[model samples]
Each structure stands twice: as C-alpha cells, then as structure tokens.
Target: MARRPRLEPRETRLDATQAYLGRAADLAAEFAAGIPPRRIRTFSEAAPDDLRTALAILSEIPDLGLVVHGPRGCAVRAPGVAPLAVTDLDQRDTVLGSGEVLAETVRALDAAYAVTAIAVLGSPVIAINSDDIRATVATLGLELDKPVVWVRTEGFRSAVPATGGDAAADALLQLVDAEETEREPGLLNLLTSTRGPELAALARQIEGLGWQVNILPAGASVADIARAGRAEASLVLAPDLLDLFAEGLETRFGVTRLDVALPLGAQATTAVLRRVAALGGAAAPPAPPRSVSKPLAGRRIALALPTSWGLATAELIGDLGGDVAALSVPHLDRSHAAALASLAERWPDLQIHVGEGQGFERTGFLRRNALDLLLGASDAVAGALRQGLPAAVLDPARLIGAGAAEAVTAAVDSAFARLALARSAAQNARPGYTPGWLKRSPDWHIKQEVR
Candidate 1:
C-alpha cells in the first residue's frame, strides 16, 4: 500500500487560494491548448476580485478574446474592468424570457466582431435556462456562421473560467468538419482536445522517432482534421474528445482509432513511442538505461479525478510496480458506477473512497497521505505541500492522452520526473517545515516548546 502522509490541519486561507488558482491557471491553459481557438462571452456572479483574477487569466490567451456579461442584472462598469460592450437584461425581461434580448446581443456581436464561434458561458442565468440561449440563437438566426459550444459551470467561481476555455476549444473543434480539403499523407493530425507543454514534450518525444504530428485543438486546422483519414492511424487521447472525433473520422473518412491509456511512466512512454514507430513503420530507439532499472519499483500511488477519466491511472501506477492503495471516485453517477465497480473488483486491494455530496474527496485524502506519487489537481499537490510532502500533479486540464497509454504515459512521466526533482529540492531546503496552525497560534508553539 502507498504510505499516506501524516495528518495535519488545513493550511492558511491564502495558501489555499494560491494553490487553487495555480491549478486553475494550468487547467485554463489546457482548455486554451486543447479546445478549438475562438472568442468567449462570459456571465458571472462572482465578486470583483475573483472576476479580476479570472479576467487576468483570460486576457493571457492570445488566440481567445473575452466579452464579460454583467451580474445581478446590473448595468454598470464592473470595477477593475476596462470599457467593453455589455448586454443587460432587466428583471421583467429575464422573467418574461430574454430570448429576444440574448438574440439581439449575439446578432450585434456577429455583425460587429469577427467571431468565428460562440459559447454561452455557463452560469446560474444560463444554466437555469441554457435552452433559452440556444433556442434564442437558433430562432433569431444568430449562429455567427460558426459552431456554438455549451459548457456547464453552474455555481462555480474558479471552474467557470477554465470551463469557458474548454467550451471555446470544443466549439472550435466542432467547426473542423465544416472545412473541406485534403491533407498530405505522412502529415498525421493529432486527435487530442489539447496538447499542453508537457503533452507537447510527449509529441516531441514521438517526433524524435521520425513522425510528423499536427496536434488538434492546438496547431491543427479543420482541413487537417477532416483529412485525418489519410493518416495511417489516429491516437485517441482523452476518451471523451477522442470518441467524438474518432466517430466522425470513421463515419466520414475511414480512420482507425487506437484506444489506449494516457501514458505517465517510463514503461508507459516507451510503449507509446513503440506504437508510433510501428505505425510509421520505423524502429524504436533502444530503451533508456534507467527504464530497465527499478526506479519506480514498489512505489505506491493513488489518484482521484472526475469519473470521466478511467481507472487507467490505477493500472498504469500498478504496472510500474506500485500499489494502487485506494481508488476514490467522486460523482460516480449511475452512468459511471458500473465501470468503477469493475475496476475496484479487479484491484481489490485498492481502497474505494467516495466523497460526500457527489464530489470526490478521495483526491484530498490522497494528497494528505503524501504518497510516493500523487496524481490529482494542483490543489492536491498544494495540500500535500502544506503538510511538507511533495506530490506530482496529474492535471487533466494540462495533460491528455493523445494516442492512449503510451502517448499519455510519456507526457505524464516527463512531468512526474520534473516534479520529483522539485520535491527533492524542497525536502533538502527545509528540514523543519512547520504546519500553518502552529504559526497562526503562537500560544500552541510556546506550550509545545515548554513541554
């Protein structure tokens, strides 16, 4: 079993916020890189400071533009926001169905801005009545001559900003089939929702084996994706996005999809390079000396993420000679419980930790353990750090499985290696790391010293 971290109280409020946002930024980058590139229209019920942080991250997207929608039906210059167009819906109009108002707003943007696509940023107003916005857009012929994507971020402060980027990217990908063209053979299109820096490193590692790659939702074009059939094969990354495009490719273009795990270790990465080489009809280079060594032998790890992700992490972690420890899946709705149950039975030793209120808290517990390798969110890593334990963050936002286990494993392994180095540094630098409560309560510290 993976050794859990020592128990401790939660960190200070500031550290929690910093850790949360740090992870949020990584997720935002993932959405920016993986989803189709386009403009964004957002509706928020967040405080001014929270909104500013969200906007700061949105502003950093060179390819994505943001148009803010007001809150509480107010029509004023939002504090800290520069002048931008606003569409205010009064209470009467909102109650009476503001479809017309929304349609007019979209039409105005269509004619005024060069919007290639549109996504109704999910919020209370929209989530409660998304059908209204979609119907209004459809009814008024405000399609923007481009794809419209809907992302749900109901009642979320941080999740909204990142989900907005994801919606934009998904909307962009949906527009790919709209283009008609042919791609040259040997120019394989990457069928991932995203290709972040770590993912890009995996791509480069694959390229080093002598294959040309065109990452979708990143540098790939609609024409490129449409012509994916011409490529020898498609590497299915995130099963959700991969299935979406893979279905289209098979139906329209006759491309084969390779269902594999997202690679994250030495063995996993090597498997991916081997697959790419085999497909491209090239020979893989010799295995790295370290891979054959027992570098990850007997290491125990635990993972927690949306059930949208498979138990692939458990398998990959276990394959590396690590104990699965415990598997906690939150939001294991009826749609996903069967799959979860099967995996749990397969890895009986893996503990099943479910969360309260449909949200996964196992991820939090995993971080608290400070296991040899922890895969979860940035907050999970931060939670570990607050207790003086180092962890590797397996952010679904920043990393995706391009071709399956081998492909994703390679990217994850690279990230894990870097994280391992950072952890080593922290451990060496601070011999007596103190918990947050001890600092906040001076009396507690004095009493302990006296004892």
Candidate 2:
C-alpha cells in the first residue's frame, strides 16, 4: 500500500556533476567517454533548494492542495508561491513528531478547499525528523476517499533546484491510471512546465497540424492526468524539468516519450515539429526564413541559463550575429550529453561554468572575459548588473518556438541600449564582493570532490 517511486536528488539519481569551470571540448570529451566530472565549491553564494521546486510543479496541477509540512518559516515562501496549507510545525510538534500535525493539516485543507488530491510534502524539519509521509498520506486517502500522495522533498536535498521537479514527477505519476483507458487516435500529450501565452501558441502550432493536444502536469485536471496514458506520445519542451514526467509516462503506461530538442530557435522549432508530426504520418511544414536584423552584430555574449534554455537560446544568439563567448549553466548531467557534444563540436574552446548561483565565480568570470553582454534569468542578470556588466533579462517563457531569435535580440539590444545605466551602476553600485576575491580566478574556491 505504501509503494512509492524512489525520489532521489539529481546528484545521486542523474549523476549530475558540478563543473565549477571547464571548456566545452574537455567536458564533452569526458562525458563522451562515460565520465562525469564532479567539483566542489569551497564557498557557495546561493542555490535554490529542492522544496520550492517541488512546490512550483505540484501547485500547477488544478485542484491539487500542497501540504507543505514544515515550520511557519517554511510556509512563508507562500507569498509568491502557490496556495499551500502548511503543517505549521511548532517547537512542540517538531520535538515530538509532525505526523499528527500533517494529517490534521491535510484533513483541514480537504475540508476548507476544493482539492481532488492532497499531497503531503516533506520539509527539512520533517526530513530530519524522519516522518512517515507515505503512511500518513495512505491513511488519509482512505479516510477522506481522495487521491492523497506524498511528495518526498527536503529543503536541503539538492542544490540543483530542478531535482525537485523529479520528486514532483514521481508523485504525479501515482495519480495517473491509464492502463484500462482506450487509447485516443492521434492524441499527443503536449507536456510542459509553462502555462503562459507561449504555451498556448505552442499548443496551437501543434493543433494546427491536426493532432489532439493534451497539456499535462501544468494546468491539467486530475481527469486529464488520468487519461494521459491514452495518448500516442508525450512531447516534452524542456527536458531538464519535464523529461522525467514523460519517461514516467513511458514506463507506466507505454506512452511514447519523444526526446526532442526544445523549440527555442527557428531551426529547433522546425525539428521539434517534424519529429512530433511524423508520429501521426504527417509531414511538418518548414519554418519560414527569419529576417535577421543582427542586432548583436559581432558582439561576444555570455549567457547564464538552464540546460535547455542555454543550449537552444545559444542558437538564437548566433542567429542574431552574436558570438556565444561562454555558457553558464546551473547543473550538468547525462541529459545534457548530446547538446554538450554538439556545442563542443562547434565551439570547442568555449568556456563552460556549471554551478548554482555562485555570484563570486560569476564576478570573476565576467571580469576576466571580454564579453559585450550578459543575459540570464532575473537572479543571474541582477548579479551581473550589480557587478556593472551589461546584462539583460532572459525570460525563458518568451524565448520558446519561432520567436526565439526576436525575443533574444530584443533583450540583447536593450542591454546594449542601456549601456549608460550599466556604466553609471559600475561607478556607483556596490561590487558586493571584496576586490581581493574578485581578483582571484572564478574557480579558485572550487576543489574537485574525491569520489
């Protein structure tokens, strides 16, 4: 009754190596030989933990209540986070056990809210306390007559926040029961972690090709999830976050998992479409040639992005006549092997920095490079701006499908146009690190871990 899929962090499960600094060719070569290089940071600035990552995915399911079993402080991330009912484990609860509190919270949430399923999420406190979440959830599911699941996630399990996505994927898989369902004709599951205008556009693009699109694990109902196994194939946009779910679908329900490159650049969009359309005996129309403005003409740029976005958007950068000087990724694993190999075959000498939110390393890397611009998600971009590097916000949502070139160019052009602001900030803004530290090599604090 308590059968739960093992939800280990990416470090252990995926063998994601921490390459604090490396070159494209060397990393690709090592990985090609089935060797994953691991590194350790003597000093880490910051990294998003697994707990939040699980929350972000679980909350996206329609009418699913997340019971974040932790102290009041853990639930405080709820402001920007989704609506989660906290166990509110006080000192007494923590000292004795929070199992009762978690059960009570689940019951209360079920009573107060309209949730088809309630997930008892673990926290650092509960993880440390060794609470039996599966038993508690199993019991609640019977008592309440609802789909109750345990999402085993801890606050400190992984620095690679995306590992939490794996935890959520395993939990979500339990809710799916498509073994008996009749397979729908040409039904393609458009799996995504995004639910924005871009997602709608992507769905339409696929739908226009005469396939029934069923978006799941994000803005999908429990009934929709239950029928996910009835689909012909599951097409995942970003492998880093959604691949695990697709793999689960394949394993559990025999749903075909199409491991296509993310449709970021125009070429990728065409490739993704052709691959997916082929499943239904249909041919994808070729993408029209984009009018490249070359906004970043002859500019050398550094991008700090996730594996999927970094690999895809790097093509967009090149399409805009920009040279990708360096790629700063959050983590690296076998999932990145093919793309890393491709990048190596092209930009053999390109610098590759793999770590989570090490601003000190970024400061040194930026200082030592002759990059004209820096682009990344908000946090990394903010760090670059503070250090007086010309940086821009690289919203991954806006960079999907055929608009990748335009979206990237707009951001890069804006960063260049705001050159005065960057210079002004360079003179007035605080460096946030000691000059001595900045002077040292970015990988100075990185020591190879002895396996």
Candidate 3:
C-alpha cells in the first residue's frame, strides 16, 4: 500500500455523472440540488471511455511514453489513439500481480526512445483486478530519472468520458515542479480539450492580449506541461473538461482561473477575448460593430456533442438566427450552471437529449422531427442525411476563438448548399429501422431511474 499520486475520480470529486435522460429544463432544474439525480438509459450504444481519453491526451504530449496496464483488447484498437505499450495482463498476471508486466513495458519504452516522461495508464480490468503499481511506478521514475505518472483511468469509473481528461490532468500535475511556484508574468495557460490540428491562430489572438499562451495537453510537449505551474493564470476553453485541471493549478500553484463559458459564437468569443485582454492589462482592440445576419433563417437544427460544445454551439446557432430544435449532449453537471441558465432563458422550449452516443435516440429524432440540419460527427448525422436532414459535421477545432462564428456559418452554408445531396440520400435511402419503431417516441426506451 504505497503512496499513490492524487487521482480523484470526477464522479466523486465533482458529482458530475453522465447518466441523465431529460430536456434542457429538466437538467437545468436539477442544478437546484448540489448533486443532480442520476438517470440511466434503458438502452445504450457507444459511450466515451476514460481510458481512451487518458490515452489520447497523454499520447498527444510529444515524447511521453505510455503503458496501458490492462488486457490487450483495451490496450489495442485505439484507432489514432496512442503509441502505447500495454501490459497485456493475462489470467496468471491478474492473480499473481502484473507489476512485472508494467515494469517491463516501462523499461522497454525508456531503453528504446528518448521520452521526456513515462506514464502508466489504468483500465477497467486493472481497476476491478486491483493490481497495485504505485511502488513500481515510483521505482521506475527513480530508476529512469524521468517523470513517471500513473493516470488512473478506469473506463467504467465515471459516466462522463471527459473524466478521463481529469485523470490525465491529475497525472500531468506530477510534471509541474511544485518546488518552483513563482508566477511568470504575462504567461497564460490556454487550457483546452480539443485534439483538432494546431491552434496557432488561437494562440496568436491570445498573445495579442500581451500574454504568452501555453496550450496544454494538446500539441504540448513534456516541457510545456512542466512549466504550467508558473503561468500567471489559466483561461479554460470549450469541451469543458478542465474543471479539475484549472482547479488543481489554482489550488497548487495559485494561478488565476478564468473559468468562463465556452466561446462558441461571435459574441461569446469577444467576451472571452475581452476577459483575456483585461487580465494582461491590455485593452482589446476596438472592432467594427457586429452586423447580425440570419443565414440560418427559417431553419431548425439539432446537435449531438459534448455539453459545452452543445450549449455554446446552440447559442451560436441562436445568435445566427437559426432555430435550435433539439440538442443531444454527453453529460450535464453543476459547472454548466451559467450556460444552462443562458440556454434555458433564451430557448425555454429547447429539447435536450443527454447521452454520449445513443444512435437509436438520434435516429428516432430524425424519424419524428423536421430538422433543417443535424450538427454532429456521429453516425446519426449519416442517418439524418438519409432522412433528408442537412447536417454540418462538428469539428471541435474550429469551434473556438474569434473565427468560431464564421467557421460555423460557413459550415452551415456548405451543408445547406448541398441540400440536393441530402434530399437524394433520403429519396434513395435504405430502411434502417422498422416503421413501427420510427413511429414510437425517440426516447420511448428511456425511463426515469427509480431510487
């Protein structure tokens, strides 16, 4: 029972559960209580796994070796996910202890590559199996003379897949030199959860505010992550998985945490810009007056994305005069109080379907509702096309900073411009579900979880 790094589960720490089946008001109402009542889907399909998330985040840090201490299944098939060395724990290792497997992988990674640091990723199997690897990890760190962190990411630990981001943050905290807590003047942490291509323009906009930006965990090296403690403040962006991350920085290093709402549209982006500029004692340059145009006028749109992305994108749609008919998000938590309130106030009748990857519900929405566009990169978007709904696939990369509104508007225009393809797709569409199932309510399978 050696001392392990601080790796608190987002479920226990934030009371952020991914299990909810409700609308905007239903979910927004739950915020009245400290912990929202848990809801479960009667039927479920694809969902986010914490392990996959942790692996993705960790692997993104260049030259950081990772070992997945789980079975081969969870370790492999992480398409475009990792350069991981999995323990591949067998029945024998599960019973006899798999520390050696982890140790061997760590040694192999260290011996072969010039990695800045090494991390051991946990999994559901290892969580259930309860094989301790703390002592081994600490010994490896000392043995290799590099940062070796244990990212506690069990797939089933939390309903919100973003909880894996929290785990990765917790593990990454070990890299920050706690001994050097002196604040670096004008250094800002542009904390985000997007794996989209490099965000040079976004960083430039922040740098225009007179602060050097440290874009973390995404396209960041081990050194960039290491110097995070000294940043003057942190500005968290969309994909709102940085609650624990920013909190940890503030708590540990006394960095200012500007936990603002996701900047998905023009107005919200300006607000974020103004906030960041004001922090660096620099005035945001005056711009021409915003001209509001309703490109999506008379159009009804539905979205299936992460909570922050859903709320912010929904707001962006509203800003552009598009009618947001429905929204499907992964999970809802207290951190979404402001965004939820804003959405509820603006579109009181906005229907909200909460779940990560429930294709049936998404398909049902297509069968029942008349939507001009469906916003998501999920298979449901294809279903929408087959059902004659124009869909603008969401890219988390473009949904930030000054160009967010422009990017979305362009995407919407492109989607609608190809309306003929969508109509043809619907006309020639093969049957996916039975007519009876189509007639039933999309959430007919959803039932309130009785306590």
Q: Which numbered prediction scores highest in lDDT against the true structure?
A: 2
> Each prediction's Cα lDDT score?
0.44, 0.79, 0.76
- Residues 1-451 of candidate 3: C-alpha lDDT, one tens digit per residue: 6465556665666666565544667667777656676666677787668887777667767678888888888775444333568788888876666777789888997887888899898888776567676677888888888889888885367767878888888888888888877778999988875655335766787888788999887768889988999999988764456667788888989888886666655566677778888878899866536756777778888877777777888887887888887887777777777788788888777777766666677777555666778877757578788888887787767777667777777878877887998999989989677888777777776665687
Model 1: per-residue Cα lDDT over 163-205, one tens digit each: 2333333333444554444544555555654446767878787
Return the clash pairs for model 3, or none: none
Residue-level lDDT tens digits of model 2 in 203-296? 8888877889999777788778778888889998767877888998898788899877788867788888888778777877787776657777
Of the candidates shown, which would achieve the greatest TM-score relative to the real structure?
A: 2
TM-scores of the models, in the order given: 0.55, 0.94, 0.92
Worst 10 residues of 1 by lDDT: 9-18
Runs of candidate 1 exceeding 4 Å displacement:
1-90, 107-114, 121-173, 178-184, 205-211, 218-232, 240-242, 278-292, 296-300, 305-310, 329-347, 354-360, 363-375, 384-451
